[model samples]
Target chain A: MSESVNQQPVPLHEHGQRRPMKKRLWWIAISPSVWAIHFLACYITAAVWCEKIGEGNLRPLQISVGIYTAIALPVIIWVGYSSYRNFRRGDPPVPYDFDDPTDRTHFFGFTAFLLSSLSVVATLFTVLVFVLVGSCD
Target chain B: MNFVPSQSALDHAGVGAESIAGLFWVMLIGGCLIWLIVVGLAVYAIVVPGQHDQKRTRMLVIGGGAVFPTIVLTALLTYGLAMLPDLQRPAPEGSQVIEVAGVRWWWRIHYRMPDGNRVETANEIHLPVNEPVEFKLKSEDVIHAFWVPSLGGKVDMMPGRENRLKLHPTRVGVYRGVCAEYCGEAHTQMAFDVIVESREDYDEWLRQQASLAVAISDEAEAGRKIFAGSGCGACHSIRGTSADGVVGPDLTHFGSRRSIGASVLPNNADNLTRWIAETHRVKSGVEMPAFETLAEDELRALVRYLGELK
Candidate 1:
């Protein structure tokens, strides 16, 4: 049964469309990359503000961090939503344990969904630091 | 080993330390509970009668591994981060400001008196109970950290930059403070006594610290002469007799301090004598040189003279 499923490969769209390996991997990696970039942006902004700009008013830092978080969160949510759609596309739904292109696509989609969820939480945590700590001190 | 109560953060005597101790308890209990839950889940999976359906297994893997940890850690992070602003809050305006500079293996302390004069002291710090004091911390050479665990959190003292830490000590007792940063050789020996007393007692102590040293007895007077002549004044300052050298710790009220050699040894005649004769043996890499060339009688007179400063 598994061999038949593997051999009958015309790229099943009912489950998921088979894309190039690089594109699939990029889809898996994009959410975390966004999170990493957001983390760097927030921290570097804070460091430069604290060092170059005097520790007087934190309004600018707060505004900049807020903007970065606002931008990053929506992107993460969109990625998470798209991945969830891909994960739920198959007739069998999740537990994509079959040895076929459709199952492989679902597996990658599930992995991407998990990564996006993790990145969303991590980005929120990064923003939480600025919310609690008002000053460089 | 002899127990030091002030060395432990759990034995909190100040407002800041109280919050820290509370946080520690919460974290510890939370961690234990999480560990038990995780272990119990594993045990349940093994001890169950039959294989769980795919849905249940997926829930066990995803919910237990990811969701559970995410929720627990997020809550913990929020709880921990909320404590930072209060911990970093500056003292109120016109409050008592104490300037402390971390030197090699010692602490140079200055109490900013209301009369615009700074009362310089070393090693020991006296604070009035029930009052918040702001410490303007600096490092004269390398990086160091001032930590009085019983009182509050530690603050780093970096060279060329001043960091401030505010502590409101509630208990009136003797506490120990140490350099939390590993500065150099003898960093372990860099410690001081924090004497929290009543307002009256604190004022009296400060008054005495501000006054010039007086050699009342003949032995003390002889030692004073020896201290001045032996070039000890070049690094140490005793306000009365012109032994003013800013390189080392101020010795105006050296005898009144609870410990000698930055708390490396107890403040006693034997320890003092030994410290003077073999400075490096007590704490290596200290800037002060040994006075091994002094005669036995001269060393005793110097020790006696310094002991009477209190």
Candidate 2:
């Protein structure tokens, strides 16, 4: 069993054509980065609207945060789907327990998929606030 | 443990407080249920004699850790956020409006009467049960929060901006209110009594508060003379008297209050004397000066006079 696991081919990335470590890490981090940007945009929009426009109208805030959620969710879902595909690439899918190059790539894919899933939920939760709170008060 | 219950948010007496307490119970019970399931799974995995496959283990971890928490937390968020609109809804037109200014270490309350006149009171608040009252909260100096935990949620009293809170007391009982936000050295001492009474009783109390302070006895009459002679009128106001100062609490109905010195002491002759003679010792950093220079007889007379203002 150990010999067969060691003999598995590196199917995703070719030997010399592999991407740099930094670029690969960026792919892992992009999901949470999108979440962070969405979070800040929602907060700044609410703060400015409350401070400058005063209370009684939440239409603008709801529309702006809705737009941000729409933009963030699709990107996160795509990233998560791609990561899931990468994570399941091996002949005997997941538990990615081996110490080979292919297994390491699979582990990274698993981590990115988990992060993307979390970001999608978090972005939804942020949008939930705008929907529930009707005014600055 | 002491038998008497301390101040708690769960001791809900009003509509808003009831909703808050409900949310707290739901969250607490939901969290405990989730904790039990997660811990039960871990205990079973550790103690059970079985060879669990990686696929089953992965499913257990993902289902227990991520999916469960996300669903539970999102449900809780939705339930909690749904309460905000009703809690923040403004009182209807022609509601009884009370303007409460958070002064240094005290509360300055003004009731807008039906005929457009304002009646001023301090340290204590009275409300009619089952009637929604609009409180226009403000701060004279630093930031303060008006929190009657049993009545409603706390709202910050900013210096320039006015924040509003609506409270409809369901029970007729005395509840304690405190400055939830720390402001100064005597922050902890800033407390007041919230008396929820019948509509007729509330109206009667407000009527008495709007009236003038009359000196009924010779001792009270003599004490009034001393209060005027000693310049106590500079920062204090006793309506229908020469003391028209707006710098301190109105003393027109001081004797009728539940507690003296912002609920620091029980309203009585001895506590009033101590508070008047050694104001700083009773509550440090208070803006009121201690009347240490007054003679013993004069102080007694002054206490007599203030005690009779009811």
Q: TM-score, each model? A: 0.89, 0.88
True contacts kept of 2: 0.76
Backbone clash total for model 2 is 0
Q: After superposition, how far is residue B287 of candidate 1 from its true place, in Å?
A: 2.3
Which candidate achieves the best DockQ against the true structure?
A: 1
Per-residue lDDT of model 1, residues A66-115, tens digit only: 99999999999888888887766645555776666677767877888889
User: Candidate 2: which docking quality band?
Assistant: medium
Tell me the tens digit of each residue's lDDT in model 2 across B1-310.
1222225779998999999999999999889978998999899899988798878888989899878878898899999999998998888889889999998899999999999999999989999999999999999999999999989999999999899999988988888899999999999999888888899998899888888886569998889999899888998899999998888888888889878888889889999999999999999999888999999999999999998999
What is the clash tally of candidate 1? Answer: 0
Point out where model 2 deviates above 4 Å.
A1-12, A15-22, A47-57, A86-108, B1-6
Q: In candidate 1, which residue ranges exceed 4 Å CA deviation?
A: A1-10, A13-27, A48-57, A84-110, B1-5
Local error of candidate 2 at residue B77 (angstroms): 1.4
Least accurate 10 contiguous residues by lDDT in model 1 chain B: B1-10
- Cα RMSD (Å) per model? 3.9, 4.6
